[model samples]
Target: MGAHRTSLTAQLFRRMPVGRRPQTEGGLKRTIGLVQLVGFGVGATVGTGIFFVLTEAVPVAGPGVVVSFVIAAVTAGLTALCYAELAGSVPVSGSSYSYAYATLGEVVAMVVAACLLLEYGVSASAVAVGWSEYLNQLLDNLFGVRIPHALSYAPEADGVVNLPAMVLVALCAMLLIRGASESATVNTIMVGIKVGVLILFIAIAATGWNSDNLSDFAPFGVAGIQAASATIFFSYIGLDAVSTAGDEVKDPARTMPRAIILSLIIVSTLYVAVAVTAVAAQPWEDFEGQQAGLAQILEDVTGSTWPSTVLAAGAVISIFSITLVVMYGQTRILFTMGRDRMLPPIFARVNPRTLTPIPNTIIVAVVVAVIAGLVPLNWLLDTVSIGTLVAFMVVSLGVIILRRRAPDLERSFKVPLYPVLPLLSIAACLYVISGLALVTWIVFLIWVAVVLAFYFAYGFRRSTLRQDVDDEEVAP
Candidate 1:
């Protein structure tokens, strides 16, 4: 046990060499500005989930789900502030993985990387599954024919492969492989489509709103509200993607901070508006077993399928973009791990032609595709929530650590209320976590242990940081 403990410590705490860090491949141009950054965060964040989350959250809190949305936005707001500071300080692509490495030790970074794999990778799969649902809805409305449930859902549900989801992942992977960049212009266009759809939804649904529907607020009580908050949290996951692009942003000190806050406010406001409209237009209890809930709401109100079809088509396009951005984030984090020699070196290798980590992207794409095609949406959502919450907790703690340890570091943004805000963030995270099932927690722990095991078995000896230290000792 003593030897095992030693080995574990050695592996997980492995370090990186400052000299070996890869140069910016292809001398990639830094063309992103504040507008572009805001667009990326907004585009990557506001889709599929918000359209569907209302169906789940409203029943839990009734009309009180609006308050729950407020709670979630506040928590996400605090975390985004912390992320802005770290991103400005580190200015790297790996997001929290890069931040943790600079402030915490190597071992902690690996664990965070593992959490990210679940966060972005699995979440992409989840989004693709959502896209599949909307795509099927769009087809049925436009063509009066529906794909067989057996051909459209996972085999786990007594069906064959999810062909549409698999195709979506594969297409995204190809774009990524070809270095198809999601420039600020493209992101802004996508954001426009997303926002326009929601506005259309609200405008149409408002005609059907009846205040009586909100009278029985909190039908399920505090327990149900808390449960709903955990689910709603999924919609807030990509706010940090804004922070991850810190290295390339012009005047990051100012841009990084504003973009993060602005994006959060815009997204939260839209989400709450959508949720309120959906609930007011129809009874909250009827949201159960709803697929393409927002689009369905439109159909019910208009007594025609055109509005629903438009929303479904918009969802399909916007959700696809979200999956691509998220999947991109996942591969970059793994590349950072590989670069540090904490995982296989292959992950860090950038392709000479694409200047991206082609192999790593392929591996991530394949794994996520399998999960999307086979796994159930409910399982994917729960696992993603757990990973994201833990990672957010770490970022909040990192903010406190960096403030104390390196008080002189230039931070473009700082968390307001200091320790109070961070403490509140942590508490809210735990509150949401408390609602997760026992099985989810058990699965999370097992995944963490497996990551720690890999760190000890391989990362210890090959760590670039350790080798650099050894070389310094023998220098003439």
Candidate 2:
């Protein structure tokens, strides 16, 4: 262990250009602010799961699913706090990957990058699949028609092609190719649409609440609650999207931390409210196999389809935006890895024409499209939760490492409670991870080993930093 630590430290502390560091790329673009950051978090977080999670979670914990929501929220909040400190200290676009490289070491950074790629890449595909379901619902409600089951479902799920989902991905790719940005204004619009539809849901659902539904809240027992919490944990995955905009935030010392905590609080509250109302409007058992559950609840409550139609439309729009943002994030992280010579150079080449990593984005879009088209939503959601939980654990640990190794480094925001908070963050992450299936852990371990092998075989030899270090010693 001691020798391993020495090698890791040596790899991490190797010298490279300070001015041209990946963090210093193209100056900070001030296109986002606190409100916009919060909007991004809310927009990325609100859709898909809240509309559908109760169905999956309720069967596990019954009415006690509300408690699961609170537990997941608290875990997410702790990780987000650690993310805030790292984001503020590093102020980079690669999120946890960049933070890990600066503080943890190259091998750990590569592992974290792999996890992030899974987190954002798989999540984009997952959201696209969800968007397709909601779009079909909207069509059925408004036009009295629906896409054929074979064309609308995944191949594994006995469908031919998820045409609507593929179409959504294509449209988002075109928008990205056209250099369109999801500005703060657009995020605000998406957030408003999402939150407004949810508010409408809560109001309509209030009319149908039955106290009888609260009985037998924990039919599944403690084990069931933990299992459901693990699944529901996916809904909170993007809460740290707020911290990723660290460089653009005003008064980041105060604003960055506040935005993260505030976004988590608001999103968690909305999630619990939605869960409680959905379960109250109907028995917990009914949520199973119920796609677009909230919108359906509105339909049942009003005895009319318009309210549900509107909600479905809102989900369609908001979920598309989420896919776009998450895809953008995945491409950027790969771009950073490429710049560092960890992955192939193709990922690093920014298009001079678009000023975006056009090739990188396309590659990610294609991969995600395939996953969205073929994989089941449940598998996608579970893999995403595993990747995100591991990455969050790394970031929390990275915070403690940086504080101890480079105490004098300037930090715009420091996580409150110091060592204790970060330690708790790790514990919470592990607790949720424990609920994941043994198969998921096996798959995760294999994936990490493959990444580490690549790091040793190619990345170590091709690293730009190693080349720079050699050149400097030769010159002297």
Off by over 4 Å in 1: 1-29, 180-185, 247-254
How many Å off is the CA of 451 in candidate 1? 1.3
Judge candidate 1 against the unseen true structure and give its global Cα lDDT, from 0 to 1. Answer: 0.77
What C-alpha lDDT values do all the predictions have? 0.77, 0.77
Could you give candidate 2's per-residue lDDT for residues 41-65 as a string of tens digits?
7877887568766767788888888
Task: State candidate 1's TM-score.
Answer: 0.92
TM values, all candidates: 0.92, 0.92
